[model samples]
Target: MTAVTDQDHTDHTNHTEHADHAGGQGHADAAGDDTGRAEERSENAASEEGTPQDGRSTAAGPDGEDVAEGPEPAAEAALEKSEGEEPEHRAAGGSKKSAAASAGKHAATGPEAPAKDRHARVQADSEGSWDDGLIARRVTEETAAQHVPTAPARPSPPQATAPLAYDGPLRSRLDALRELVGLSRTRLDSRTLAEAGRVLDEAASRRRLSGQHTVVAIAGATGSGKSQLFNTLAGVTISETGVRRPTTAAPIACSWSDGAAGLIDRLGIPGRLRRRPVQSAEAEAQLRGLVLVDLPDHDSAAVQHREQVDRVLALVDAVIWVVDPEKYADAVLHERYLRPMAGHAEVMFVVLNQIDRLPGEATEQVLDDLRRLLDEDGIALGEYGEPGATVLALSALTGDGVGELRESLGQFLAERGAPARRIAADVDAAGWRLRSVYATGQRTGLSEEDRDEFAARLAEAIGATAAGEAAERAWLRNANRACGTPWLRLWRWYQDRLDAPTGRFPARAQVDEEATARQRVEQAVRTLAERASTGLPAPWGQAVREAAVRGAQGLPEALDELAARAGLPPGRPPRPGWWPAAVFAQASMTILQVVGGLWLLGQIIGFMSPNLGVPVLLMVAGIIGGPLVEWSCRMAARGPARRYGQEAERRLREASAGCGRARVLDPVAAELLRYREVREQYGRLMGVPAAR
Candidate 1:
């Protein structure tokens, strides 16, 4: 049997003993053959209850050892009844012992014993030993046991902080820039939104990585040893240094690797990457994150390369101006580039490179002269004692004073002010240019009253009213003669139309003089209109002249319109291009009427026979009537003709007013609109209120 503790097997054995005692007693009473019954019962009990510590419920052989824990222990009387009949039982016990065993078994066989059988024998035994009423108490005690503690609740992750808004004066200027850009139809001609975006992006990027590195550009004239100095400072051949002028055709960038990609990208150079120092370890450490760009000569023979240098130099954070002993004072370099860059003071370094070529004492004198020239160019270096523009003596080819140059670059980069400042500077510069175009303000269309007044003034200046009066008088003079008495009528009509009237015949003097006077007046009015328009602004001045032409031609055009409306007969028209001939014809028609009337007057005065006089008068009247009718028709149209002239002049003035305003104001308004868009975008990015 496997090992079992005494507590484990005790309960099953007790139950088996009680069973044997009860069975022995019951049989002994019924049959009255105690000894034999007891012996047989002992044998059965031994068979039923085998080894106690084995997995058996009773004292049986192999089949009986099935229980995991021993059954409950036997009461005293049950133990005695099985003692003698078998080795385990006592056979000497009388009926009283058997009866006592039966009674003890009866008590042990109560419900508590079966309940105990459900548990391990040791547990059952211990429980059986307790009062039967104590079982509930034991379960209650076990249920009351304490639980272990748990961990504290963890905290949630935090949200990211937003970018701080820019609340400075610069914001207002940016707003204006956006307005200006909005004025453009497609892409802005000058300051585009792309430029604004670039500015913000550059600023934000620099701000984020501020205090990390400084970018310095080595800018100079074509023949200066800028590349040599760049190479010397880097302590290796980072840039191509040569004897030939304009050797560095592209910008060469050298940086200590704290991510120079952004700078390189901004410079917009293709096939150019960051290079490490090839020579001096100290220079590398001192200039860590300090990028030095060796620009192509600004004054290069090739125009494109010069432009490339100028473009990149504008965006660099700092500049190192390399001056040589020979061509340090070139006027073009000083005037074109250096003077213009006077606003950028924090990052300017002037290096008198190749100082070894000059004598020691002469070096100081030359350096002083260079300083004076720089000052004249508006590049303010420090005074005699103060830290002004950094001027250093260095030989890029010989590696002299390169360490100091590297240290200067290190100091500037170490300032760690973010790129936003540089971007702000650029934006400010751009804004100044844009502001110049739109310095005035928004403009709407011209007022109707103003246009009306202008038109009226133009009409008065051209004497439209006077022209109408002159045409009326001319037509009246011609009409009176045409309607006069056949002999006198024809004669009187022509004479009345002319300046000098005659009694017997209409004078050619009246017609000739009056017609010439009308011509002179018309010519004078036309000249007045042209003169009035002379001092007006462009397009407007042209507009007024055109209007005058429109007005001057209005009478003829109106006549055509009236004739078409009135259904008048089409006649052989006088050609406008043949002004000299038309004038002659008009004068001749007046002369013809006078001559015909005088012939009639001769007959009326009785200088010929009655028959001749009558026929001659009728023919004379007919001949003069056509010229008189045409002149009358032109005079009747003069009122409308004058109004048409006035109307044409008015229209020109009105149109010019609007056109002038549009040219001046519309573009400015568009720029303002674009600038507003940019301001809104910037506000969203920076989480700030847009400037008004």
Candidate 2:
């Protein structure tokens, strides 16, 4: 009879008294007809069957939240019906040993479960060759399953959408990680990337160039049954199996077929722990190029054990986290490993081992809860972890879901994705950690407006106004010396000498006067540096600040030298081209005055009759011409002097501004450039798409 139908397995529960006097045949008939119910009397025979192989108490756990649902538990009741045509109508006969041996024999060659995931079974002979079924005792207890009424397929676990293959997520995540790592090589903390890169290179090189096997790590907390699962998959006793805490101190490598020496050698496993599996055609053929390692407990009390786990974790192609139903919700497992490596969900597998210990209903319930926690940890499942992370439920000691795991490893190896995907996850993790320093949005440099303000302040510090005024006055004085009336020119020159020394610089006092403005120049540089440093990482900003202030000690002396050199053009502008004309006009006027004066003297001596008229006319002409020449020269010199002075002032300011730019603004600009460079590096490190 089909007692282990998917429908019957759905509502597994612990109860009493399923073994009745109705005999095994009658029980099978009733199971086919009535779905099981969890009355108080279902587990009568199960109680006497012996200890459950799950190695834990078979009691219901506290009701809790939704969990990460793993693969359905393999059903055990597919073939428990009586063999002969006649109904052997009798209660379980003889000692409990015979009943257990009989149950193992039936399951070893049992019919298939309703689901297609069921593996072909190896039959047991009369002498008790029953190693193929779950723990012998558990199978013995399940023999009376037909007598117990079960709920019809409790609830088909929410049918998962078709499995999402790892193509998109795996490739995309890897590319993203590579780009981020390349950018971060120069900036951010290299220690993390260096460690990650070393592992990446080692893994990718070994897997690709060597064309070797996939290195899969079986990891878990102590007592999670990883060793047993590892040995079961290998079909041999390669790893130690025991109840002792922290049983495996070193990782053990098990290779399916012989060409994996290179891959295992790179993993650095000791020769003693590494063993080649005995090849079996029906078993693990697909895992020919696979290297499966059973690692020490991740939460081991020995620091070395934890360290070994971490080292191997960083190097492996993929990691299978084997957790028991009891400690599936462990914080150390989820936080330290799962949550941080969520970017690598593509290459991670979560196994809920020892599902046989939980009754069918509790199995599904706990699986769902585990899934919920994985969701919180950012691990997705399904074909590609799209809907949820891939979770498997199996019992290593019972040999119950081990075959499916072996097959999955075969499929994973054939895809040739674990190494790239694992590295991609690493890069993703490193990028996330540096987000604080690398997330600066855009790259920019100091603005022209800011530079101009700084330049103006530096010009002030160099005393441009003092130099420019002196230039203008000097130009005016030279013009006056050339064009002024001869007698007054000497007097004016002498008078001007005491009144502020036109055209000559160096009051020496002007240098002292610039002290306050020098401080202003320094302040301007600081302000510009501060503005440029905004939004940068602390190191970059500090570097910019230091660069801006580097030449502070020599700045004052440099400014003073620049100020002294910012003098008027030598000897002022040459005398106006028209000055000679003014001199000739004045000379002619003097000659006329002399001639008129002589004529007047002749008239007074009575040397010529009526000469007084000519003398008087000449005298008047000379008098008018002299003053007119003087006025004309004065008017002409006014514009030329003013223009020359303005030209000199302009030149002085240009020279002063240049000095300021070189000593002050230039340093500020250098700092800004440094800031822009670092900012660009930050963008690259963060993997921001727009950093150019």
Candidate 3:
């Protein structure tokens, strides 16, 4: 391979342009130079088919042409020197030169460059010593540039020009979470909602930081050799390693390449503790985008060290828990971190470090024991081709099995998706934490039957039926007063006067029943609230009950007002058309009685001749006929009275129902609707369909 210097690159470009002009001229003089062209073609064919004297094989060039593969020693040394000086500088120079050469060649030859000219040009460039390594470096740089991880593109805020379908799954989930937080802040437990909000905020922050680097924290108990492992992977002693109880006091970040400053800052790592790994070309290439963090010992004696460990651990994309055989089963590690983070198995690694201290057979035993312990801690082990937490056994001091750990990390970095996976796990955990507050089964609302029953209860509570009966009785009383015998009517009037001072009228009794009406209304509301809240989660059930109570605060008073207006009308009940005729018949009987009495008096006093039998018959007929008229009128009034009673009952019942619906049922329904909307949003946040 040979490298293309700046001067050579420029000259090559000029030569290609000159060649294009010469080739066009040659085509114009094709017949005149036929023999010479044939000789040139013969030479080109031999160069293509025959092997070179140096015995170098051919490789495909950037434009699909074959060129010599081996590089001159001098050119290869120069390329290595430049790469050592600065890989970025070498990459930049190589890319510019490669692009220029490719563009010149395409312009000179069009789509189908003549084989003879191509061979000739290749031979000339080969003499000038262009190498395969330079081409390879250019290709690598271009590929890396194309595949660099970028922060996820956030969807623009909702606009008329853009539909929601344009947003990604993450955006949709985040929006759902926002809606849930807004709707359920008052309804749900404060702690649960606060946790969900924290998750959302963290997710947003993570997405906004560096996506190119995967920050993996190396955490372990005191004296676990985690710092040793971090140094081994970095190929430098970036973290302090010693026999002391707490070797690392603060978190140290070692990034393999550039473009992770935002993430490091977010992790709160100071500039003094930031580091770059020193590794060979192949190792550096594999781990180009890794940000390895060395955290303070989790089991440190100092509280601040442990707190720092936890704070850094929360922000990192993944974790490598280094454990020695002695403290592998420490209860603090298992109970405090492992069990609680079981859902994060995919982004975790449990490394059995310092394994060289154990004998070969003992090492295998220790590994198996550690696996059992992790299982007990609820951490899923990725074994036998399953995807879960990775388990590794390595000795950082002895360098035993360190290569395997490095290889695994390289594979992890290649995917460049750790940040996304970590955020998704957090979201899943948040949803799980809030699962109890939401019901997975279908939610029921107040049915029409329930509303109808409530209306009936309200009507009963106001004594609407009793009021209707009272109206019928009043109608009958008035009819009696109109058609009764004069003496009996007079006696009834005197009796009503005697009863008036006792406050025992039907209207007065209704006023005393107001307390009972209020009690019934309260009972009706309580029953309806219970029925509405049944089968719902605790928070939602409480919300429903509260809404019912609020709506029913004035329900009793409103129902009473309705009853008063719809019940028996004021003054005497409406008189039937025949009441007047009945009254005249009764008056005629009264007149006949008076005339007979007068004739009897005259006969006794000898003012006129007396007919004692006729006078007695007249008086008896008057009394008997008066009673018959009154009885007939009462019988005739029965149909009208019954109709009046039913009409009053119907009016009061309907008014009571209307009042109940407006005050109680509507408000409860509105509360239920809000709950359903929030529930659906929660379901979307969890990536599931809500039960309707």
Candidate 4:
């Protein structure tokens, strides 16, 4: 009996310990499930709120401190109830295994289990001191919340459209340049404008052709190993090398890929002269868009060979100038090609071929020297990340530095911007060359003061002031003729008839002859032209002069006609209101004198009684009164005559000025306006503001 009781007690104790362990394990599993569900719920809520799940919330309290949130009220309530029932759940040893099994099943099945079993397991798990049931409920609620409808996304705002006139920077510039050339055709010199036109044409043709291909011309002087380098770059012996003075007579093209036929054709390369590289993946991939051309020697003795080289160089996208140490600084190459084309440094390459012949360290020295010479030639050196002409040394015969050249070419090809860059550089070069024709030291135009001076000079040439003086004298003479004593007027007429042969009285003011007038007109026009042409470019100044000369051609004849029409009328000068009274008084005085003289004569002849006092007094009075009235009339006519003369002078001056303005000033102004328009267009083309 004692052994049995002891064994039973030991077994019961073991059973209790096993139950406790199982319950503890169940609690741990439940807690883990609750923590996972809580984390899941938190993630869902954070995502819904568009907040980061990095252990912090974007939400802040009113006081600007971060706010920490707890679980939901329903979850807290369920957790409290589970804690309240924990002791009873621990006391119920019989149900402990079932509860642990159920908890395990719920944790494994998650929310995918049947709703009834999940809820029953949650309640049983809640009977322990764990919040697993609350967390599971929260997850379910959050999952359901995901289906709630959200507001539709906001629509994006509309974007502004670009203007049609602004077709990218390069295209717009090209178009503007074309317009500028057209406008400048009449105002500028043909040589510079012609060059600008050629640039426009080339840019248009290049853009229309294959943009994928880059046409690079290998140009050098005679016996400069141009063909050898060309063949090496092409990886095939396409161009024939020879020891002759001029090895390549014609341009030979080698393309690295297909579809370069259009580009090659535009370059004027014949089908027979076109070649392709040997099929290699690496070469094709690196240089697929390259169109290499071996041009004839630029300094060839043969005229046709040099001509061919020049033509091809003008049409190519880029140039590789192959020079040996002997002729790297050749005067002809530097002056003719490099110096003139300094603006094209971005698309230019100066290669020092035949460096193998140089001794140790001479390569670097030659390269440095070549670079210095290029600088003197005005070509920018593209070294160490600067934008300029690329200078490199390589030898085709010894295959030295050829790979580096190839690699550089490959990198250049990869950019696929060679054609555009080349055209842009050409435009820049052409603009620089034509700068002298367009640019000026100061703004030029016709000024009001200049116009007035020109008109004044023209008026003076027509003798307008002299005409007015003559009109004044004519008025005075006519006033005397109208108001003088009749007897004196008769004597003057008789004397005028007698003196007419001597030409004493002038009819009108003398004017210059047609030839003299024309000279004066031209001089005036030239003066105005020179004034307007100040600080203008040569071409524009010449144009202004031509316009002034052209307008002045008909000016002299027009001014003469105007002078004739502007003169006073051929009849008598206008009679004043007091002229009639003066004439009547003079006539009465003459009659008195005649009567007095008759009385005196009769008395003396004894036809009547002698009245000596009355007759003598009457004769003296008549004589004095007639002279006095004539004097008074002459004095009054002076003021009116002067005014009349001034009016005539003003009319002539005004007429002459009008004629000059119409013929000369208007045309010159029109020419100036044209120049301004073209200048504005040039400014746009060059990407600068127009000068005033």
lDDT of 4 at 251: 88
Number of the top TM-score candidate:
3
TM-scores of the candidates in the order shown: 0.40, 0.64, 0.68, 0.64
User: How much is 117 displaced in model 4, in angstroms?
Assistant: 84
Higher-ranked by TM-score: 2 or 3: 3
User: Candidate 4 at residue 422, lDDT?
Assistant: 76
Off by over 4 Å in 4: 1-194, 222-225, 235-237, 240-249, 278-285, 300-302, 354-360, 395-403, 435-450, 501-558, 581-628, 662-692
Per residue, candidate 3 scores C-alpha lDDT tens digits across 1-692 of 11112211222334334433454344323322332333343334436656332223456643345654442332233223332222111112223333223222222333244433432333323322221112111112222222222121121232221111213877788788889888988788788788788878877787776666788999999999999888778764456677877878898787765557678888887654666444246656789778889999999999999999888887889999999989999999999999988888888999999888897699889999989988988788888877789999988888888889888888888877677777777777787887778754755788888888898899898877877777777777888989898998999989988876321115524655878888899999999999998877788889999988998999888887777677776667788889999999999999888888888999999997978988788888798899999999999988888888778888989999899888888888887888789889879989998886
- How do the residues 1-692 of candidate 1 rate in per-residue lDDT, one tens digit apiece? 01011122232234333544453354334323333334343444535555232212443211123222222233333335433332111111112333344323323333223322322232222222111011111111111121111111111232232332344655564554454455432433433356655565555555444245567789987667887777566543445656777688788676654345556666765332344343124544566667678898888898988888878876777788888888888887788877776655445788988887887697888889988888887666855655447788787656677768767667666655324345555675555443323232333223455444433443333333343343334434333333223455556656568855322211223555445534543453355344543433233334444544444443322322322332211332112233344345445555556666666677789885545555555556656664555455455545543454344334433433333233322333343344445445444333355444
The Cα error of candidate 1 at residue 458, in Å, is 10
Candidate 3 collision pairs = 1-70, 1-71, 1-131, 1-132, 2-130, 2-131
lDDT against the true structure, per candidate, is 0.48, 0.57, 0.69, 0.69
Candidate 1 vs candidate 2: the TM-score winner is 2
